[model samples]
Target chain A: MLEDIVLGLGMIFTPENLFWAFFGVACGIVVGAIPGLSDTMAIVLFLPFTYYLSPIAGIALLMGLSKGGNFGGSIPAVLFNIPGTPQAMVTTFDGYPLAQKGLAGKALNTALLSSVIADACSDLILIFLAAPVAALALRIGPPEYTAIIFFSVVIIAVMAGNDPCMGILSVGLGLLLSTVGTDPHSGSPRFIFGFYELADGISLMPMVIGLLAFSEALRQAYGWLKRQAEGREEPPVHIPGNQGLRWQEFKQIAPTIARSTGIGACIGIIPGIGTTVGSYLSYLAAKKCSKNPERFGQGALEGIAASEAGNNAVNGPNLIPLVTLGIPGNLAAALVLGAFMMKGLIPGPTFMQNHAQLLYALFTLLFFSNLFTFILGKFLVRYAGTLGSIPETLLISMVFVFCVIGAYAANSSLFDVFLMFAFGLLGLALTALKFNLPTMLVAFFLGALLEGKVRQSLAISNGDFMIFFTRPVALVFISLALAMMVYTFAKGFSRRRHTMSH
Target chain B: MIRGKRLLGLGVLVFCLLLWFLIIPNQTEGKTGAEFPRLIVLFLAIPGAVLLLRSGAATGAAPLKGEELYALRRTALLLALVCVYMLVIPKLGFYTSSILGMAAFLYCLGVRTPLQIILTPLISVGLMYLGLGLGLSFRMPAGLLP
Candidate 1:
C-alpha cells in the first residue's frame, strides 16, 4: 500500500499528467461557473475528446472537472442570485444575501476555502478507506444493488417537493422514458415508435440539456421580457471588497464545514443520493447546529461554508462506486465510465489489480485538481463581476444557438433536433403543471440502473420475492426506504394539520 | 391554472391507461425475466393520475393574472423563434441561420438597439463558428449557401 501511494505520487507529478490535470480544472471551473451548464454536461461534451488521450489522462481530466465544477458552482451562487448547479442552490440561501449586503468577496472567499478543505479531507478519506468500502460493496449482489437504488428513488421522491404523488408520477414517467431504447438482453425494440434513432433510446445528453438548460433558458427569457415590458431596470451590481477572513469568523464556521463535509462524503458514497441532497442536508444540519439559526438564510458565512463544503466533498467519494464496482454513481460519473470503456478499460473488482498504477495516478490528479481550483478561484473571484454582467438578451440568444448546435452535434440527426425540441416542450409543460423537473430528471437517470439490477436480482432468485428480504444488506436498505417514506408522509400530514389548525 | 392542470391530468391518465393496456402485454414475456418491478411503475402511475385529477378538481379554475399571461406569451414567442431557426438552419447554412436565429431571439427579448441588432448576431455566429469549427474541430453543416 505504501509503495502504491508512492508510485501514485510519482505518476501524478509527471509533466503530462500535471498539465492535463490543470487543463481539466480550468475547463471545469469555466463550465461550472456558467449558469445552466453542469459538470455532467461539461464531461459529456468532452467525452468524445477523450478518445485520443491515455486512460490515466482521460480519467484525470474527468476527476479534475468533477472536483473543480463542484467548487466553481459556488461562484455564481455567491455573486449572482442564480445557482450554477443544483448543488449550489443551498449556497444561494445565504450567498446571494451576502452579495446583496456587499460582502460578496467574503462569502466567495469562505466558500472557496471550505470547498478546498472539504475536498481535500474527502479525497484523503477515499485514499485510505476506499479499499474497505469496495470490499464491502463487492459483497453486494444484484438484489442489494436493487435495494440501494430503490432506497435512492424513495429518498429523491420524498425530498423532491411538497407533493410526493407528483414526485412518484415523475419517477414513473422517467422509467417509461428509459424504456424507449432497444432492450439490451433480448434485442427487441421497446418504445422506439417507428424511428430508428429511438432504437438507441433518447440520448441522455439531449434529454438533460433539454430539461435543464433549455427549460431554464425559456424561463429566464420569460422573466427577461416581462422585466423589459414593465420598464424595470436591474440595479447595477456592487462588487464587494476583501475584508480578509477574520479568525473569529473562522472559529464560528469551521465546525460547520467539517460536519458538512462528513455528511457529504457519506451521501456521495451512496449511489442515489446525489450532490444536491448532500448540499441541502448539510445546510439543514448547519442551520440546526448554529448558535443563531435565525441568521441562516440571510448572508451567514456558515451557510456558505456548509453548502460549499458539502457539495465539493461529493467529488471524491462519488467515484467510489464507479472505480470499485464498475457502476457510476451519477450521470457525470456514467459518462466517465463510458470514457473508461472507450479506452478499453473496465472498472470492477479486478480493475485495481490490473490498473493500480492508473488508479493511483487518477487519485493523485484529483488531489492536484483541488489545489488548482484554489489557485484559479483567486483569479476568478476578481473577475466574477464580468460573468454576472453579461446582457441577458445576448446570453439567451447565444445559448439558443448552442442548444441547436449541441443537439445536432450529438448524433448528426435532424430527428434528434426535433426530439430535443419535443422534450423541451414536454419539460415546459411539466413545469407549468407544477411537476418537479429535477426529481423527474434524476429518476430518469436512475431508471435503467434500477431496472437492470431488479431484473438481474429476479433472474438470480428464480422469481422468489424473498431474495430482497433474505439478504441483510438488502433488508436494511429496504427498511430504511420504508422508514423514509413513512417519515416524509408523517411530516407532511403534521404540517398540513398545523396549517389547518392555525 | 386549474383547467390546465385538469387537462394535463386527463392527458397523462389516458396515456397511462393506454400504456397499461398496450405496452404491458407486450412486456409480459420479459416479465419472468424483468417484469415485476415494472408493476410498481404501473401501479404508481394510476394513483398519480388520480392525485393529479383530484388536486385539479379541488382547486377551482382561476384565470391567469396579467403577469402570468405575459410570461406565457413571451415563452411561446421564444419557442416559435426556435422552431423557425431549426426549420431554416438546414436550408440557410449554419452561419446565416445562427445569425438570423440569434437576432430574432434578441429582438424578442427586447434588445432593440440598431447596433445590437447587427453586432450581436454577427459576433454570436462568428464566435460559435470559430469555437466549434476551428477550435473544437467539430463541423457545422454548410447547407444551401455552401
Candidate 2:
C-alpha cells in the first residue's frame, strides 16, 4: 500500500494528468450549470477524448468532471431557483430563498465548502472501505429496493408540507404522472394517451425545467406585475451578502454536514440508488435533526450545506462499487465503468491486487481534485453575486429563453418544449393550491424506479407480498415506513383538532 | 363551495375514477401491468377522499384577491405570449424564435429601453449558440437562418 501510494503520487502529478483533470472539471461546471445538461452527458461527450489519452489521465478527467458537476448545479439553484440537475432540486429549496434575501454569496460559498469537504471524506471511504461496502451492496435486491423507496416516499411526503395528507396526494400525483409511458412489463401502453412522444415516459429534463425554472419565471413575473399595480414599481437591486463564511457559522453547521456526508457515502456504495436519493435523504435528516426546522425551506445555510455535501459525497463512493465489484452504482458511475472497459480495464475483486499502482494514482488524483474544486468553486462564487444583482425583467426573460432551450436540448424534441410549458402551468397551479411541489417532484423522480422494483419483487414472490417482509433489510425499511406514516398522521390529526378547538 | 382543496379533491377523485374505469383497461394489458397503477390510484384516492372530507379543517391560505387576481391576468397574458413563441419556433427557426420570444417577454415585463431589449437577446442567444451549437455541436433548428 505504501509503495502504491508513492508510485500513485508520482503518476498523478504528471503534466498531462494534471491538465486534463483541471480541464475536465472546468468543462463539467459549465455543462452542469445548464438546466438540461447533466454530468452523465458531459462524461459521454468527453469519453471519446479519453480513448486517446493515457489511462490515468483519462480516468482523472472523468472523475474530475463528476466531482465538478456535482457542485455546479448548486450555482443556478442558489441564484435562480432553477436546478441545473434534478438532484440540485433539493438545493433550490433553501438556496434560492437565500438568494432572494441577498445571501447568494453565502449560499454559494456554503455549498462549495460542504461539497469539497464531503467529497474528500467520501473519497477516503472509497479508498478504504470499497471492498466490504461492495460486498454488502450486493445483498441489496428488488425487495430491499422497494422497501427503501417506500420509506423514502413516505418520509419525504410527511415532512414536506404542513399537511401530510396533502403531501401524500402530491406523491400520488407524481407517481401517476410517472406511469404515463409504455409499461415495461407487458409491452403495452399505460397512459400515453396517443402522444408517441411520451412512449419513453416523460423526460426528467423537460419536467424539471418546466416545474422548477419556467414556473419560477411566471411567479416572478406575476410578482413584478403586482408591484406595478400597487404603484411600487421599484425593482430592488439584490446586493451580494457577506461571502466569507464565519467560523461560528461553520461550527454550527458542521454536524449537519458530517451527518449528510455519512448518508451520501452510505447510499453511494449501493448500486442503483443514485445521488438524488442521497441528497434528499440527507436533506430530510438535516431538517429532522435541526433545532429550528422551520428555517430549512426559508434559506437556512445548513440546508444548502446538507444538500451540497450529500450530493457531492456521492461522487467518490459511487465509483467504489464499480472499482471493487465491476458494478456501477448509477448512471454516472456506469459511464465511468464504460470508460474503464474502453481502456481494457475490468475492475473486480482482484482489480486492486492487479492494478494497485493505478488504483492508488486514481485515489491520489481524487484528493487533489477536491482541492481544485474548492479553488474553482471560489472563483465561480465571486461572479454569482453579480448574477444576483441582475434586474428581474431581464433575468426573468432570459430565464424563460434558457428554459425553452433546456427543454428542447434534453431530447432534441420540440415536443419536450411544449411538455415543459404544460408542466410549468401545472407547477403554478399546484403551488397556488398549497401542494408540496418538491415532494411531488421527488416522487416523480423515484416513481418509475419504485414501480419497477416492486413489480420485480412481486414477480419473484409469484404475487405474494411477503417477499418484502421476508428480507431483513426490506422488513426494517417497511416497518419504518409504516411507523412514520402513523406518527405523522396522528400528529397532523392532533394539530387539526387543536386548530378546530381554538 | 368547491374551491381550493375541495376542488382539488374532486379533481383527484374524478381522475382516479377515470383511471379505474376507462384509462387503465384502454391503456394497459394484463394484471402485472395494471396492478402497480391500481395501487397508486388507491394511494392517491385515500388521501384525496380524506382531503375532500377534511378540506374545511385543512383550509389552506385564503384565495388570491383583487390586485393578486389582476396580476394573475398579466401573468396569464405572458404565458399566452410564450405559447405563441413556442408555435413560432419551428416556423421561424430556433434562434429567431428565441430572440423574438425574449424580446416579447422584455416588452411584456415593461423593458422599453432599446439597448436592454436588443442586448438581452444578442447576448443570451449568442452565448447559447456559442455554447450549445458551436461548442457542443447541438443541431439547432434552421428554419430560415442559412
Best by lDDT: 2
- Which runs in model 2 stand beyond 4 Å of their true positions? A1-115, A122-131, A228-369, A380-385, A470-472, B1-3, B55-67
- Which one is best on TM-score? 1
**Global lDDT scores for all candidate models:** 0.76, 0.79
Candidate 1 local lDDT, B37-102, one digit each (tens): 365556366535644544322456579777768877977988999999988877988789888888
Clashing residue pairs, backbone N/CA/C < 3 A, model 1: none
Off by over 4 Å in 1: A1-69, A80-86, A89-102, A246-253, A271-300, A325-359, A490-494, A497-502, B1-14, B26-37, B46-57
Docking class of 2: medium
User: How many backbone clashes can be found in candidate 2?
Assistant: 0
Error of 2 at A150 (Å): 1.9
Taking chain A by itself, what TM-score does each prediction score? Answer: 0.84, 0.61
- Using DockQ as the measure, which candidate wins? 2
Tell me the TM-score of model 2. 0.71
lDDT of 2 by residue, A432-458 (tens): 777876567657756766788899999
Give one digit per residue, the lDDT tens place, for model 1 in A1-502: 6687788777777776777778888878877776656666566555545655677777778777877777778877877667877789999999989989889899988988999999999888777776766677667789988887778677667666666656667766776777777776677777666787878778765676676567767887888777766768664554757655789999888999899999999988876567888888999999999889999999999999999999878867887877776655666666677678668787765677677777877887778888999998877877777766668788778777777776677566677677778878888878877777766766665666677787788779887878999999899999998787667656655765676577
**What does the lDDT read for residue A223 in candidate 2?**
88
lDDT of 2 by residue, B1-146 (tens): 23466777888899899988888877889877889999899988877776676533434567987888888887888999999999998899999998988888898887889998888888889898996778667776779888
